[model samples]
Target: MNEKLRVLVSVDLDGAKARVKTQGHVTLQSIQGLYDVMKRADSLVPGLALELDMTLAEVEPQALEELRGCARSHHLPLQVDPLQRDYRFSILAPTLVALPVAAPMLAAA
Candidate 1:
């Protein structure tokens, strides 16, 4: 499994804002990489406002919380796109529900 997280950074011509897009799974180990990229982007333009897009990525709950904390304490002026779904769930519960059930005749075919 490729554990690497890909980060793409873009800054506006005026250097007043920066946008970051992340792809791949974001685990505890990879959170640092994401933070570093954000820091670098901020340095490029002092007081740069950052917008983070994680729609293309899956982030572990712990990592997500840590990222939020870091951003809050550092005052990164970051705005993150909302996650599609909540990751916190009961261990006994199914990760997916309402799965399609194929017809019995189809199995025999």
Candidate 2:
């Protein structure tokens, strides 16, 4: 499993609304991609919101705070769920998002 920061941008049909989806370790040092996405979204979309799902991620509180900081710096709306467990990370989304955060559910621990 690779531990790297990844970000995905989703835009509404009118292109006026956008949000971000992220995965990976999201350390303090690796947020360039996230920043880029937020900046692009802000420039291209009027209101940029973030949808953060970090339950499967082994994220420390500081890491979460760093992510929030990125959002704040960009003046984007941020939403997070440290306890969220409902998601199916599709391989088509991105390599980073699909890099196997959790063990196979059917496998024995």
lDDT of 1: 0.59
lDDT of 2 at 47: 44
The C-alpha stretches of model 1 lying farther than 4 A from their native spots are 75-109
Q: How far is candidate 2 from the true structure (C-alpha RMSD, Å)?
A: 11.5
TM-score computed on alpha carbons, candidate 2: 0.49
Global lDDT scores for all candidate models:
0.59, 0.48
lDDT of 2 at 10: 80
Q: What is candidate 2's local distance difference test score?
A: 0.48
Best by TM-score: 1
Shift of residue 29 alpha carbon in model 1, Å: 0.6
> How many clashing pairs per prediction, in order?
0, 0
lDDT of 1 by residue, 14-92 (tens): 8587778877777877766776677677667666777777766767766666666555555422433122211111111
Error of 1 at 97 (Å): 16
